[model samples]
Target: MGFRFRDVLTSWAVPSLADLLLAALVVRPYLLPGGLDELLSDASVGMHIRTGDLIRSAGSLPHTDPFSFALPGKEWFAWEWLTELSLSLLHSWFGLAAIALAAVVLMTATSALVLRNSLRRGESAFLGLLLVMVGFQTSMNHALARPHLITWLFLALSVTIVERERRGPWRGFWLLIPLAALWANLHGGFAILPVYLAVVCTGLGLEAIWNRTSWRGVWRMVACGLAVGAATVVNPYGIGLHQHLIEFVSSPWAIQMIEEYHPPSPSLGEPFYWFAALGALAGLTAVSALRRRGVSDALVCLFFLISACKSARHIPLFVIAVTPIVAGELRWLWDVARRHGGRRSLVAIVHDMDLGLRPQFLRHSSWLPSLFLLALAFRGPLGLPSTFPEKSFPVEMVERNSATLQAGRVFSTDAWGDYLIYSGYPRQRVFIDGLQDYFGPALGNDYLEMLSGGPRTEELFRHWKFDTALVPVKQPLSRWLKARPEWRVVAETPLAVLLVKEH
Candidate 1:
């Protein structure tokens, strides 16, 4: 553990470029204006913390409503209880600093694994950076402090392990069995791994059929898949956890209403555009890569691509699946361009530059520890975020009307409801929050009807008996409230208005 002066100096002065990139990514969020608070933009993270805390205090997982006043005794499935417990423990131990750091590390690891996979597949260092950049493009938009990010990390590692096993001798592919158990507790995104496993096995099996190779690899994957499936049932809920997840994802009511669960559309902005473009590239390259040895790559990429297209939430998963495949094929593209006598072309120039940059990026030293220590030491100066962004959440509105929030049942968007719990939970409960699966379709329909001014809007509203409503200025409900004399605006911010109903 002793650090030699020369070792430290060499590491600092001539650090690994890969390590430097990772360090920069890890440090960026902490150094930003919001510090680690930027990750809390989702606000659902608040309830997760509350749930985790509840689990810790109660000495058991919850099976009934714990944070919602809307449905006081509704059955609940706290499937991600382990992740919540860890988040609560981290918050208690180091505040948001630990939570933020953990998230950033998962994100960084996912991208780094993608880069490493590309290099292993024959792409140069600089070329792999291209996919890494594109992967980050869409992921940052959904980069909240949640458990799903852990799945991205585990899936990346799973791909690395499976691919290595495909190439060489038994190289720890069996480890994925235990990891699957851990992943199931962390996030439902573990569900994607089974899909990935099936895709890989089918693709590799196809390759064997075409090349007349051994079926051992394919059978090995099948065995691994069964083992992984069994491991997922190791949770407290056991087999019922899988049954719950299946029903939740398949229920048209749940997935159709949630924006993230919806298919890609123009309203999603730049991330949608980038995903469309990358998705197109993945399709083209995946189908064509089969001309070489991209059998497994094509199947895996196409499956995730289809999933991401169906639900925008799957885009990061799609990105992880395809980046290495695309990077590897792009090298073949560069070679083709070279054979066509494009030596003086811009492609050639970039290729030349990549060759020159490879040595610099590959420089190995003790940069990981150096950069990690730097991140931890700078936490104080960086100013750990005390609250989420006001623009994204009703921070000021909540602060000014904290008493009203605690004194009455509130109705707001799920995100605002989450912030409410984070700010004043045990004393305050919302009519609804982000846990759509737990609330079920009837409540979801009522919520949408209430907001949209449907025929039963007033009826649902009166039935719910909401005392306070905090809504965005632009929402239809805000305008609806304004037209009614019974609802009065007590406190206002530029982005949100807090309205209380007359008793």
Candidate 2:
């Protein structure tokens, strides 16, 4: 048989309507009124950029806290060094516009991979679209320009590969080795990779026992798990990264104090909405499990649902883990509905339209969807702001009062500290920032105490001997400092107030 154009087109997977919708949803955050820079809302991005600058300048990652005076020379792990380096390079070459565009591209690519995985599993186009829509809503809270975005993308890819391997030969298992290594350097989220592997392997082994079938891929899966575990330590910190990560995760401060670590609450409106939706979907899947369900799918969905409930940040992981399960369940539901009197329903309508499309048309038109996504990714850099949003950061205020800020030891909020470091580091080291691990339990508690104006707040002030403070105008600390006779307001803005100690 001779090679033909049709065969070539079919060999490369075509993007479906679901894939295009996912791409659009991923780019939605960047299309706000203020433009792409508005999507860079995470304060942590400032410190990430600063760290990237340091790595680029020194030609190596630093192992000591350099941005905060409170933890001067303290041992620190740049777990996100790779991500930081990328952010730094992009910001340096093309400014914040490039970073925003890069984030949109990464998120869109991640969504595309998830959509492709669902389609590859023989899920209906309607089911794929519904899953992507739900996944987007679930992950919107975490859609920021930070290293976590990198983790999300890698995790999606890793899960897709693992699922593929579970269904077929173990060819892609080896790829997880390097992916785990890269993940370790990019973010602490690398810890999830092993957990995912263990869960899948255990599910497969249990499934074999449940069905009284021979265990085919269990040994290979176990070996892949071992290899991935070994690959995780290939980062700069080696095993120390694991130690630090465990310490951070296990810390009471991290679990109780961090907003992201808290359980999903109704107080968080958008997040609560999606969390409830996922819970309802999980219930539906469980109720419909009798019709069609795999042990692995059920277990993974339960594990991720519990995780998402316990900590809001894990919502995206749950969204990713549950997509295929949701698609499978929805496919079953659609079939059931069609067999009943619901053939005239929306799902049936979509099913008819999808079935009517020719394979040749999809293969030949795949390039259009791919090109559309590429265009959406580039739209940010081409037409959006080149700098971070002024309202989000005290950019203009920092620049105008740079000399005054540099004149003294400054105490600033963790959120503001990142921006301060980004703009005025070396001359102005922070008391605290988003790198909670570097501060540890002791310093972290102290920072929180001072932030809440605890009884020891004065003691903290005396210990740090801070001569100036940059804080939000509406903060309690700012109000108290304004009332102190010993402190004078040197500069003030609607966003922040700069206070200096008076002689």
Candidate 3:
């Protein structure tokens, strides 16, 4: 097979404006309503700032969880320091909508940039970017204003930049230093950076030792990995940051207790996202091997693929890490195909297979982008009918309590923790939150028992010394409280029940 520069350009050129804009229409609304935006909405901003308060004040008091109560004198994760600081400052200066708007812009731009770069560098850019989009779709709902999103974008770009540079103008390892630094402060997921760097370095070392490659390239790769690892120490917690991440990961209770942390079970819920992820992984591996391409990088692709399939959060990383490799592989196949049959015959067969889309060079020149933006502006992120089920939260119940609740402390389920924090209860301390490990297994089990209609429900409630409790209407504690004269049901809704303890 022979490669032509024109064919490569056709495959790698930027997607047309029409295509880009249409993608925007598809992506914008999903970015808006509940997922991450809920964290920045009028409901969430106040509590987020309180988290910042704990940090800036250098105080032991926690803004969210009751587990922090026992660990009062100790350090907090501050995993979301950068985001909390940014949102805190933004809330003080302007408002939460500013942060939400910023999130939308950042997420939109990150998506566009990934697509643009993927299209600009490879012979099978369109298909590569499509796979990237599909890969991200599995984890798209969680892409909110949290620190993880910043790390997500940075990690995606870091992989792209390094992969693109493998054969291009190789820069110093210094660029990665800042990525690690910012990533460490942005989210604890920065721990994944060392794993990624190690993987790349290992691949490079294997190439040098076994494949008899240049030692120079191997040393540089190793140096870059080490430099990035050192840069993680630049954050406020210094080396202790890694300890936090290790402890968090080592916590087995979360996987056993937290739903998101649990492994995927197709029989339990939506199969589309998982299936989409699996399809992308299979497509990448088969197509890459078919082209007889970079065997070492194939291993890297496999690592991320297995990780992604095992946990839903890893889908975007797998997509970002492998998209360009797939493109390179497809490029090789295209070249081979052109040799067996002329370019004309090869193109015919490719199109017949519905293998890829043609580059819309004219898309960059159209007014279609304007229309797409207008549609986004009109439709907003909620997308009308709402993506998830409405009964997911007890909005009316929360609203009713919003007026009556003077109680400063409350107890609620871990799943509803983020929602309560976002519901403008900045001063309220939840019995639980997303930081699962901090609560310890015993308390977490007690929380479950309290909600499970167990006999120990009342005993656990008194043990926690909760001023009031907000639980599902279906909870045993709710029923017990409703029957007791000492506890009064202050508000009731199909989604949740609020009970106030009689003084």
Give all TM-scores, in the order shown: 0.90, 0.91, 0.79
Assess candidate 1 and give its TM-score to the true structure.
0.90
lDDT of 1 by residue, 169-222 (tens): 585989999999999998888888888899998998999998899999899999
**Residue 292, model 1, lDDT:** 76
Give lDDT tens digits, candidate 2, residues 1-503. 35687666665666555445655677666666766666677668868887898999999988788887787766776788898998888787767766766777777777776766666554576567567777887778777888888778888898788877877776766899999998998888989989988888887787788777767787788888999999999988799889988888878776776788888888777868877987789767755652353666767777888888999999888887778777777777677877775778876776788666423222323554466446545745467556567787778888988988877788888888888888885566878888766677888888878777678988989999999998888777888788889999988889888889987
Q: Which ten residues in a row have the lowest lDDT in candidate 3?
A: 381-390
Please report the candidate that would top lDDT against the real structure. Answer: 1
Cα distance off (Å), candidate 3, residue 1: 40
Best-to-worst ranking by lDDT: 1, 2, 3
Estimate, for each residue in 411-469, the C-alpha lDDT of model 3 and write its tens digit. Answer: 77765665566554444456666666767788788777877768887787777777677
* CA RMSD, predictions in order: 3.2, 3.2, 6.2
